[model samples]
Target chain A: MNQISDLITAFLEQCERTPKHIAFSQDDRQISYQQFEQRTKKVAGYLTGSNQCIAIAMDRGIDAAIAIYGILRSGNSYLPLDINNPANRLNFIIADAHPVYIIGIGPCPENINIDSQETQWLDLRDLLISDFSYRNVQIKTDAIAAILYTSGSTGTPKGVALSHKAITNFATWAGTTFNISQSDHIASLAPFHFDLSIFDLFTSLSCGAIVSFIPNRLTLSPSKLTQWLCDNKITTWYTVPSLLSFIALKGSLETRPLSDLKQILFAGEVFPTPQLIKLTTLLPNVNLYNLYGPTETNVCCYWPVITKQLQADKNIPIGIPACNAVLTIDKTTHELLVESDNNFSGYWQNGKLNTVTFKPQGYATGDKVSINAKHEYCYHGRLDRMLKCSGYRVEPAEIESIINQLEGIETSVVIGLKDITSGQRPAAAVVIKKGHTLTHIIKPLRQKLPAYMFPCKFTELSAIPLLSNGKVDYLSIEKKLTH
Target chain B: MKPKIREFIFQELIFVANPDQFSDDDDLLEAGLDSMGIMRLIMFIEDNFGVTLPDEEIDPDNVQTLNALEKWILRHKK
Candidate 1:
């Protein structure tokens, strides 16, 4: 099959063989493959051949799953909107996308008014209940599948348009690389809107693995999450490093028996070594992996945690490219370049292909990496986030990783602020553990880190500001530092 | 209830801020309670009271003062 949607039909045929097998689990609800297929067919029937851009404003549930596949079956690219986003941001995206229909699985926003463009509003439950037959339709591999919006460096959100081939390549490669099986139960930690969820959903579906979704309320609650993991017997989980750090610090993993968890994949940001160490200590059996990719490429490279020696090195290498993906580091700039089958078509609204100053041909990676003696790639933060201090160009991630090693410093952000005499001075915004002295911590941080890399200014924060996608909000920190 | 609220605020502020210097009426934002600090306070409030804070109620002013924060909590409690 050339297209990803055809693979879904294969999955459906497999479901017929194992109809009693559990397909999805959310909170207290569990849906079998048969029920899920029937519901998906109903949704597909209701939304056949709709050319209008359809926005799926549903929470993480069975209905949301149906809505996503339904839109794809109808030959329309689905836009997953985080209902928790600010009205202004949502309006900007909605206006920019100019969707013809908005599907709400739960409650639709009443405040923000849309333009008079014949927007069809449908409750997902009602749509799923409607009479419709599952018609096998042909979808081209190059056809646009989804448009995911991410915050740009300039504050505006840019939608990345992904094709069926890109998504299928990623899912197939990920399934093979991870050795995902029909018996595996993958936990969906990332929101449907985030690129992380694309692998969580599609990869699992392709392998006939059960996809379990954690409730939004218990997402950050470590204790609750621990219990959820144990209760569901979750085999695999995919999320950002920030959430993993939070869970590790809060002692969530220690509370429950996480022996069933086979794999833990972390992406979006750098996974701190200390947190990785703690995770290895708690659940040594679980295979820990660091997935590296921007939204442009779903996942280009991954470094599977092989041994403690790799973890102790402080620079956990984002391993070689997966199947159908090739990675090369620019010799001049040392920037990581990825030429992959999983690369997105282009940005949605502006119709610009790789305008972020990094894309060359099919390669669009913005990260600067250095190949080790072993030939494994070690990440050195974003090129734009790096700063030159005291004649030495310093990556903030280098100092930030060291800062996090300090006792009682829960979270740390290293930023470069403009100095009148020194050109640029590195400043750190830190969130210390309870009852820890900020001054005392910074003193030792100076000893551990170099003179130029030591934070010139130390600001004590209770928590690190998080973006909507759960990554650290560096823009907000920079704004605070400048002010 | 107000005394309890004050005590909770004092405890949380100490964990995150300079406890000895902060008074009940002290401006948290001005006294180094940044966005991250505000989020910690929100988490503490949610965990302690067993209440979920909606995204709409996470305004700067609602978390600025001890009295305002207390009022906000009480309003949500009802």
Candidate 2:
């Protein structure tokens, strides 16, 4: 238990200490630490030694939670595939990672094609009922614990692998810094794949706090979402800014009360300035923190926002480094460089990218940051064309490739536009072949992409403007739209 | 109002293609409209139909289908 380098040991210690305490909760169901331990052990028995990489494809429920713990318990890395994503994208991930085991609901989702010989699917119903005792496996500190794939610009998904050492360091740092305790009830709002969930899941477990899930069904009705938080007595809440903004705008929080909330942590995308100000006015007693980190380095810096900080004309500063991370700006490009044990090992099967991402010392975070007068890092934007829409990292080049592959599409380019509610939205501009209308391109694109990735708007272009370098002249297109 | 609702589903919401194929009782969530999409639908309803949907009226069972959506709209519509 004193060995914090191994996350599983630290988590198991909490289970031993508080066996009857609630570990995780969904709508009407709650699982205690003892039950969680037993269930995770059962899942581990089915998956151990079968694959180095175990993929979790279940919905957001108790089964998915057990699968995650079991994968870690089995000493294998877990890859969480979003159940709502397009089958094409899911198939792409399966083909790329080639995970040996896929744990999910029985009967694979329609249109998803997997290599049957290589991949084994384990139904959650069967896994839960298996009569197997907990297996104690030797998990090395350097062994990969989780693999998170982000959108790649070149039409492929790049996986970022985090070792047990990295996540444990982060979880321990979060637990100590946030002062998480058994009395606190933490809300798990972020999806399993997002790095934000790491702090909610591990930090809470490290301290024996109950982790509550914000059900997807309740999210649409902001009032209900607010009600759930108050009803559950969530002391600590973590989610992306867009969801917070949605509640502020749509949820009648002004009339309702949330006396139990102590801390609110937001990250994954830039929070709109006006929404932050509005939120501060409503919840003057709550402590708000703006977290900043890419998937490569999980939450390296954070800003504890005060009322005055929200009113500042400038962007919020992503405060100094946490958990022994050395953050510095590149001299020429001003790109952020992070030297930390918390940084991921490297991208999966991407040796060329490893050379670029994992430099001689640390990971080269492509994000650019500037030091504010308060001596904290202020986010400018990404150095690349990557965009964040609804907290999902998007690549315009990826969408453009998909569009260009469609029949009757001559050329295509996608752009991100700043939106008031969702932070940013993707918009596509396409030049069509003869005998084609804009409507012709919509159906195929919708089928291939998820809802968030779908273009908010589409424009028809006679010809795609280009620079002398033969690259698409994106600046001119942006200017034209503005004019 | 029903026709306008149908048009909005077809035009604004891209998830439903060939609106004629959709039944009145189809579960919208199962049809691929996520939580964000549902919020966007609420905004569209408020803007176009001139109705302010209160918190209680935003229940999942109430807006699960086109028939339910139309009934909900009729109840709230100005």
Candidate 3:
């Protein structure tokens, strides 16, 4: 329990120390540390390490929470595939990662072309807790604990695999930095797939703190979400900047007295200064921390927003390094290079580790950052065409490729439009093929892409404007869409 | 009013393959209208319909479907 490299051991130690303490609570259901330990052990018995990886398609509740730890306890990594995502994307990930065990509500995704003989599907209903021996599976050295898939430029999602050492290091740092205690009640808002979930799940539970699940249904209603937070007396909360902004805008913070909320941590995308100012104004006493990192390096830098000095004129810097992260800016590209203990082992592709992510110097973060007057890092956007839509990292190249593949599309350029709600929404400018109208492209595009990636605005351009060097003119397209 | 609601939702808030085929009782939340989309829907309602939806009233029961949304807006519009 003394900040060991093994996350499961730390969690187990905490469970022993505080067996009666509330571990996970959702809606009316609450699981104590002792109950969760018994449940996790029981669930682990079902997992035979025949396949080293498993895909959990369960809803974001008590079952999904138990399944993740159980899988890890069985010496296997897990991918918590968001069931809300388009089936096309989910099937792609299932087929790509090839999880031999699929623990979910029903049958594995019909589209996955896995060897039926090798695969096993365990229904949540069937896994009843009774008399079962605890499986003390020996975890291999440098074994991956979780695999998170992010939008890739190659028109497919890339899985960033993290080892137990890396996540434990992160959990220890987060627990120490935030002063998480047995008394603290933390809110789990971010979905399992996101990197933010690491702190929400591992950091809170491992530190003997109660982690409250924000109901999936309540996520869409900010006012109700605000009420839920106050009612729950959640001391710690972590999620994307957009959701925080949504709550501030419509949550009616004026009416709700969230006296227990001591800290708010936001990451995954930029927090607009205006909305940020509004949040600070609403919650004057609560501490605000802007956590910054790519999936490659989990939370390398962070900035604690100082309330009085928060000027609308100046943008909030990503701030100094955290979790023993060393940072440097490339002289030529000004790209932020991160070498951190929390850095992922590598991308998981075709059942092999893709270690090509690290450059000669360090992990070349696609993001370009510049140091502010206070020597804090200020974001300068992506070095590539990657865009953030509502904290979801989106690649224009990927969307363009999807669009190009559709029938009656000559070529398309996808651009991110500045949006107050989502930070940016993808917009497309396309030159349709002969005998094709813009209407023809809408249905198929929606079917293939998730709602976040769908183009909010589509333009039927005769010919896309070009630079002298033959690149598609992005500035021209953005202007046309806005006007 | 329902037509205006449909137009605004389909035009900016969400994507329905056939807006015409989508019934008034259809679940907008299931249709991928998230928190941000709901925020925009409120703004659209206030701007176009001149009805200010109180923050406390922004619950799933009121905004789950087109008919429910229209009823909530009309009740507030009065």
User: Which candidate number has the best TM-score?
Assistant: 3
DockQ of each: 0.05, 0.29, 0.55
- Write candidate 1's Cα lDDT for A359-442 as tens digits: 564564667898888777788866777664432345677677767878888978888775322225577789999988986675
Most DockQ-accurate candidate? 3
Candidate 1 clashing pairs, residues 3+ apart or interchain: none
Model 1 docking category: incorrect
lDDT of 2 at A482: 38
Residue lDDT tens for model 3, A93-198? 8777878788886665564445556557887556645456765876653789999998999988889999898898888999999999999999997888888999
Give one digit per residue, the lDDT tens place, for model 2 in A198-241. 88778999899999988887776788889889999999998888
- Candidate number with the higher lDDT (1 or 3): 3
Off by over 4 Å in 2: A1-3, A132-134, A350-357, A479-483, B1-51, B59-74
What residue pairs are clashing in model 3? Answer: none
By TM-score, the better pick of 2 and 3 is: 3
